[model samples]
Target: MEEKKAAALSAEETSAAPSLNNNTAIISSDEETQGWSTQATKRLLWRLDWHIIPFMSLIYLLCFLDRTNIGNARLDNLEQDLGLKGVQYNDCLAVLFPFYIAAEIPSNMMMKRVRPSVWLTFIMVCWSAAMIGQGFVRNYTQLMVTRALLGVFEGGLFPGVNYYITQWYCRHECGFRMALFFSAATLAGAFGGILARGIAEMSGVGGMAAWQWIFVLEGLLSILVSFTAYWFIFDYPGTARFLTEPERSEVQRRLKEDHGHLSNDFDLKYVFQAIKDWKIYIHMLICMAGFCPIYSFSLFLPTIIKNMGYTANNAQLMSVPPYVCACFFTIAASWFADRARQRAVFMLGFQLVGIAGFSMLVATANPSVQYAGTVLAAIGIYPQIPLGLAWNSGNIGGSLKRGTGIAMQVMGGNCGGIIASYVYLSRDGPRFITGHSILIGFVGMAFFLTSFMTIWCRRENARRDALTGSSGPQELTEEQKALERELADDVPWFRFTV
Candidate 1:
């Protein structure tokens, strides 16, 4: 009887138990009306993962497809049909980002007031309609207008979802989930290539060209899947239908205990705090450094492959492999990042991988070698982004702070997309050394900036430890704890994860 009792309390006895502050005992809270155990914790996470992740991932997949289908269409002859001139296609790419970037901060701010299901549903329908509209554009001006609208609708989905994930999972758990969700984008890339190739067969069916069919067909799929989001996306843990009331209480308690400070109340001050903080900007700069290459690759991979002596059809078929490789690497790396509780280290290492890939692209004269470089380059940049955002969310304490920081990070990434659009021009085809070399310099800068962030955070954590005499979360009274929640990560006991 004693042996069974002791085993029940042992968290390390089972691998399925969610992470504990201490592996020696199962954590219990002030109220435990229904029994909580390792198995219960495991089951709760499974429900969250199944219920939230697949739908959110679908949202992300369609979100990315609507944007990068442009890349696919570009290969299928979007330029020729629209009579696009030099830099006009690039203008079409560039026009979306400004509107995309402008909407995110405001949308995230609105997220605090609105439920995620309602907000995301509105955005999805708008963008999918705009995506369908892209199929009918006969002029560059019409193309530019549709692209900009797509941007405004799609911009908030990523950062908003990033924030949404945090409300359910704690810091150690957030990174891997973010990677899983982001992996859908890489999947979209792979899937879209094959889907676009099939949709190309629809050319001349509706008095439309192949490129138009790419937009219209893909947009139609997204619109069909979007309404399901309203039914599927859980508002928060407290109200999840799949979970029992006791399980919901336990889930909420675990999140509160994990964060050390929790509040559902909103105020503008938290948003201002996120904006004024220097850390948000540093992470934003890190994003600019990483996302530039990623955007370049996604927006132009088929074109880059075509320039390497393949037909446009062959290029579309070929683009799938790199994204497949990326999806695998991103999930593996994030799993490691979460287990190790190391963010900056993995992020910096991934940046080195990107730098090396770009070096191969710039130096190689061989097409086979250049194609290998593209895979490595995709491998490098794709995972680096989620790791960076994970780090950003891990450090910020409150909802508004995290929402604002995540939006800012996305903004920096889109800013990189702007730079990316200009870098690989139609004139720079075959061996785009200018684009490759500039990305290398930026990725290198990101490496240094991350190293600085690591060092600075470590120093700050030490200062907090010395001043407060606690390196981890400490027991506190109810009144003092209220102050901690109010101060958020600024509270002395709240050490920054380096």
Candidate 2:
């Protein structure tokens, strides 16, 4: 009697299956079936980290150093040499982001078509050449041209890499990986100052100023690294050469199980779909709020320290400690965030910490206290970046939607860079009270937006759970499941990570 009922049920499921493909067999085997062990997973991740993280991090470090070294160059008379007056220096800083913003989405789309290694390396090379050209620029217009070109080339890297990393790691595992990759910028902050200080001694070499040497050296380093990246950087899982067939299959299976299904097919409609999703805008707002402070401080830290009465060399050295602190704190926070599997909670907590740091800056007169506040601000801001990025990337499923969503979020957020350039005016030096106050308000807004997102995601997850009758993937007929997989995160089986 039980056998008969089971047969009937199977027949009914087959009959009701949606017309997709005829392969209706369910894969009920566990990880053991694919020879996936804890040790194997560890070894695979280690291999990925070895190959992927360091290369990506190195690229970002160079990208950041080349982009922001102008702030260091300012101390070496770059502005005077270029005959920049009034808000011209600020305008140069501001101009980068408009082109940067405009290029990001299109660049990401191109990256998907051209492949990551080729696209990423191509951009790196272009930006490096632009960076080198800055050293030869004799006038403000020439400098602006180089800066604009640099922006266009560099804009795609961060979001493109962010999306690429998500393709390899599970949702829960991405936070720390992102932290490891992003910590390069903080490390760059620490090392770039020391590097800039040392390079300043090359003044009058090759008939160029110290600032010129700074750009030349860093740009050369970027170009060298780009050559290496061209040879070393792997494409997506399907094309990766290092993985065995079994290992590759296991990775694909595991990713699908960890998140929902993904599609590689390019569809412009995904961009519209992502745009209509209100959650994407919420995350973008949080990112924008966060970036305002991060870019403002990173681009101006040396100058800020100099304003505190340190010499240029001493100010460079002083800037190192805060970034060093931020590097360690960012890694630790990401590890904890990944372990706890709680992005929004951690993001809110860190944002509040940053707000406190800004408050200290605004409320204090003592240079020592303000410097301490800088450390706190670095600690708070750097960690939340990876958390927020991973949070949005992990929650958005499907390759096309994730790509477009990440690009949109990054593009929207980078508008803050423009705002940051203008807010920290030359006249606002010594205290920069207006800048600090504005940063505090942005951080506050970030906190509120993050809190709201947390609540909304939780509610959405609960609603999905109620509909599915379980908190996990629902059992559906094989054909129905096949159809659902193509729907990406829109499928009821998919749950948003809060």
Candidate 3:
């Protein structure tokens, strides 16, 4: 009887254990589900993946398209239209950068305080209007005005978008989304070139020049996109209304946890303090060095292809391949970056490739080889942008500080745009020997800086680890430690992945 009674009790205990575990699981899940209904979670994830991403990507696509359509216009007699000769075209290109650099910092600050959905959309609309106005330019003065207007509005786009992405996604999720948004630039290059070819073939559409069609169609499209952006795009997670109240709370909690409990506080003093930091200068140098070739390529790709003995249409179409390669590399690089949880190795590697490509271009004159260099250059140049943004932004501790830092980096980096415009003077157009050499040198410098920054970060992490006697190579205060845990749970929390 005792043996039989023991057997019966063991069976009951095994059966009851699962029931107890199930109840515990239910309670834990329920607690986490607080303020997050099933409906809300479903809607939020859906909107993020399906709607917001594509919408924003298209906006950036048009932005890049409008900015670069100038390349196509160059082939369509812009020089003749203005009666330009010997560096005037290049001078016009160079003029855009000063304004771009001057206005970039203020534009970012405005985005932070004025609300993104409103300001960003307004800027887009304004720039598109400027682009359309280009179609009406009968003299160099009118052209200059439109170009300046375009710069004034476009100055906000890239940096603003980078900041905007952070407000919605965690560090880990950021790479893919950043890649998607950044890839729009590549897509714009491809599509803009292709579109230019088709539109250029439509000579004298409504008695306007072929170049006018380029501006008119693209500008109108951009304006249309702005309306949609204004209607649908939210300022931040805190401002999104598409989600239920429960879902809204979940988003707020997630963002707070992921961001080290930092809130977005707009203070002019803090912005000034961020600007004063020396690291901001270093980042600026890195961006300027890295982006010189990119901006140069953006402006000169069609011209470069034309020199290879291709027809005007063929040259325009040829611009597509390099950018297509770049888009793939960008997405692949970002994926590997997020997966490996490292940024330095990929960044250094890509920049090194860019250096090599630009260096090779400087030595080669053969059409096929030069064409190959273009592919390598595009891939090398674009892959570094997102990695850089993530690496620096992730390290920042506060939203306000990060916004300021990003704004500064962007504003400072784009000095290259101005520099690049002047580098390849019209006299050196068909064979831009000096320009290629300078780009190679800058690319080499960028590689060195990225490598150096990576090593420094690793040493810092090691020192921190030793001080804390923690399991990892970095140490933090209790508050920082808790914040790290929260951030890590959302993402893998790998060290600066060099």
Candidate 4:
């Protein structure tokens, strides 16, 4: 009699399951009562934001400062001290990206095997050590070795953080969270200049140059932060000790409702699926186009400002405002993008703005006009980064697929960093017309690509919406329901966010 009753209840639930066209409620009343309320989710998100976002942001801050401080060091006579000639300084910058690109996919895969806290903290420590080694390097060979190590260690961070953040938030919530994370780079830019200027004053201390002092101090700070991060960074919802059992269940339930499934299993099939998906390649293109200007600006802004006829000190100080502007603009844009639930539109709009800024830089000879262009360029380009990332994360459903897709996107995009390092040649000097032109062309390409992807997603969502009958979730057997739960965004009921 008990077995018969169980079978009857299972049959009833299967019959009541939601179809693609049906308004049948999918969430259980027990779940609704337990913790799916707006207030509960809001409280959970706030807790996550407080605990997660700030620490992740700080890690990236250190990452960017350590990686790009070479640009600052260049201004402080690193080139002269190391006897770097012609493109050697550029070579130092470019060499890092190859290692950086090579490490991203594998590191993300490793992060899946190891916990994020363990993996990220370990990388942070390694990169910090590399940064410290950079300070002690006496020649080009030593500098290149340190740069390569820095790249390999630091490569895991952005993709790792991106994948980790997606686990905590629903699709709509990710834009702002990602913005908060990506904003750290701009914050690094803003403070890095001021910090570099101050460190430059420490020249001759302990028989070190200003550039050496910059690396040592910043690397030490990173090392200190890594110890704290090991304790603070939370694992996924199911395993995180900070949350109560009910909270974990609620978190999982909410994500499952938002998009079917929340598979944490590491499947090779999903990785292959991600690689085969044409959308990943398109996203890769967008990532590459958008990042070119951003990386270039981060590395060369001080030099660019200095070329405008200011003293090196003034240039360092001046570089702060544009990044500060970018930081605020990114937050605002991300907030709007989340509220609108529109990704591609925001990305295209901002890319156009960046193109305009680049146009100004290319066309104008006036120092003030060029500086204003820099402000516009930073404001425009940086905001799109988080939007693009969130867009890709939201669209990709399965855990392994999402991780692999994001890693691929990041890996391909970072290749642009290599391109950026070489574009602003010493010959371009004060008027980097060639570099600006290249940037303008890429940003324009991104704009058109974003439009295409947006249209593609919208059409795909429509087609999924129009499906009926057994093709929908309503007809799923009990075993298939279980499979669908693990399939995530690949489930027919899941709709791509456009």
Candidate 5:
């Protein structure tokens, strides 16, 4: 009797009992819940693995392709055609980012209130149409409008998708899924390069420039995919009909267990709450500092590659390696991260990869070594983005809070876009020593931010554990128990794994 009683109060049993009743209840409930968890997880892994990743990836890819295709267009005499010179072209790139940032908070708020399928479809179609319009621009004014509109619509994407994934997957599952979606942006870079090479090579078609063809074709594809996202994409679990009731229950239960909390509705109050949390600002800086160099290169990879003496076609082809490396590394890192349920260490490691890549570029004038450095830079830099995103998402509890938190992250991180535009200009090209140096410095800063954030979180976690006296083989929390019904991880008392 003494042994049984003592065993019952063992940390895991004590914490888990809050959700289940006793020994009998434990067996029965585990039998039922585990069955469903296994089934739902399998179904999600199978059905969503290809469909969701590819679909979400397509949206991001188009966003990236449309936004940065201008860099490729520059090689085709876009500036001369528009009678723009000096800083005018760079300014065009610079101006779009502020508007993009301004639009994020509102766009995310609206996306949460409205149905995601409806909102995202509308945004996707709008951006696609805008990209097509970009092809027809005769001067700077027309280009500016198109770019701004692109910014407005694309701004919704990051936050909207971030919110959507939290609804579908458990906390641990989120890192890989987010990485999968992010890698699509990398794929877009690869595809955009190949397409640019082909279109630019054939620029004389119907007297249209290669750059014009690049915009027209990519835009048309996005418009077509927009309709597809509308038909295929599922909203939140409650709104997802393809899954059975049991599957739905399992998804909700797992998600509830994974995080320490969950909430319905897009409450405006959480936005203020999220803002008050200094952690939000630190996360913002983490994103902004890390991404400055990343966005710079995303916009200017073709130009950078051009310096290697690759032909326009060859330069476009060269763009593929970096993006492909980015995609592969991102997938590998995210996979391991989700499996281990870790985030910070992975982010730190990747940032170091970026620092090394950029450092090599800054130090070496040899095109071959520099080219290898670009690939490493892309690998290290691109994967950490989704890691940081998933890490932040895990910490923020309510759906409304998550939405607002992500909106802030996206808006803050993308300020790098503007900084990048200014940092890399036409004259700075070929060997942008200044640009590479700036990237190295920013990546180093990002590493510091991530380290500090991790230490801060660990200390807070220890304090909470000590207060509760529940630290055992399994880390348990009252909030976590409540969260299981409200949020779920693979284990009981799974606090945010940041």
Candidate 6:
């Protein structure tokens, strides 16, 4: 019954909706895409998916692995060695987020100035070193310092890659690409466990503990990847070295068609303008709410599982399945979201799944049920991150606003990340009902906000459609159209994706 309903919805959407929605590139099903064919566009995307997504995916995978391995380290007796007691471990976790948040918008601004490849590679190198240094930390203070450094450097990659993906892909195309790129994060969760367990046997190796091996080995791998990834990361569509001149032109032209002449040039006005945009703030709020649970789950899943009566080694093994399940679900959801050409519909529905999951955790004292709840929660939480990211980028126009706004949204989310660190208290014990309940609230708030935005965007798009009054984009004067581009999301032809 659900499948049929979904199919009907898909059919209706395909028929009723314009391909060139608010955040989407200017194209139509019946119209020729400038001189470029739709098949050509798909081929180009295929080319880009091959070239761009892999390295970006790998980079994100490493970032997730480095940052969240602390959870795995706990299972390896890191707390005992470092003497992190009571809330001290939580404090160490929380310390990274402020620096992470602080670095984001500035890092994004610099990334645009220097180009993504250069900036992302530099951050990867710095964070890799920080991750390596984490393994060498003798005490909590040193751990805090290394974590802070890691935060500063690792902060850039997520927002950076998000902005970078927008440079290559169209708005409608972004959801899947972002999801595929983010699949690495789920892989990181799964692999972090596998790696953590595998390295556990080496606890006594070379005068280092298993946690140290996890940190050092993963960090060194990142360093190696950072050096090799630079050449593949590439610049914007206009300057891609792998593309032929025509391909580059087609790419840029397609981007220009979709978004009205997005300029990558660093501009103070655009940054300030993005700060002023209410929609950007709404994006920020949504992200802030969404990431609270996301960070909690990612940073503490291993520990959460360990508390479920599994040994640390068994917890590592068990943790892998939820993440593995989430990876597939995340990718599928994004693909379906893109196909439906709607955001809130899928998002709100899945958020309920997450809410239901967490409700189980809070309601149950049974470890098996609680573990099952975690799976549902993982299924619910992971997809929202990429979908929200793509939706945020899709709604915003132009490069400067995109960069600044995306980073700002992510920064807000990381603030939630900080709050997340303290949610699962030691006193909460096996159930951690407080933490689970908190997650339910935050994720529910995110759902409510997204629903509100859906209504707002739909109303705005209707107003714009009515204003255009059957006179298409071609009927508008060149100057008027250029002004629309300058206005970004406020223009008549540009309709926000609900």
Whole-model Cα lDDT per candidate? 0.81, 0.81, 0.72, 0.82, 0.75, 0.82
Residue 449 CA displacement from its true place in model 4, Å = 0.6
| Clash pairs, model 4 backbone | none
TM-score, cand. 4 vs. native: 0.92
Predicted candidate 6, C-alpha RMSD = 8.1
- What lDDT is reached at residue 473 by model 4? 32
Clashes of 6: 3
The true-versus-predicted C-alpha distance at residue 454 of model 4, in Å, is 0.9
TM-score of each: 0.92, 0.92, 0.85, 0.92, 0.88, 0.92
RMSD of each: 7.0, 8.2, 12.0, 6.3, 8.4, 8.1
Give the deviation of candidate 2 from the true structure as CA RMSD: 8.2
Model 3 per-residue lDDT tens digits across residues 322-412: 9999999998999889878788789888987887777767777888888888899999999887777776666554456667777777776
Q: Model 2, stretches more than 4 Å misplaced?
A: 1-32, 471-473, 482-486
Steric clash pairs (candidate 6): 22-495, 25-258, 26-258
Instruction: Select the stronger candidate by lDDT from 1 and 4.
Output: 4
Residue 3, model 6: Cα distance from true site in angstroms: 54
lDDT of 5 by residue, 66-177 (tens): 8888888887888888999788888878878888898888887776655667789999999999999999998888888888888988888877787677667766677899
Error of 2 at 194 (Å): 0.5
Better model by lDDT, 2 or 4? Answer: 4
Q: Residue 320: error of model 3 in Å?
A: 0.6
| Model 6: lDDT of residue 228 | 82
Task: Report how far off residue 322 is in candidate 6 (Å).
Answer: 0.6
lDDT of 1 at 340: 93
Our model 1 lands, by Cα RMSD against the true structure, at 7.0
lDDT of 3 at 438: 88
Which order, best to worst by TM-score? 1, 6, 2, 4, 5, 3
Q: Tell me the tens digit of each residue's lDDT in model 6 across 407-473.
A: 9999988989899999999898777888898899999899989999999988988787787764543
Lowest lDDT block of 10, candidate 3? 15-24
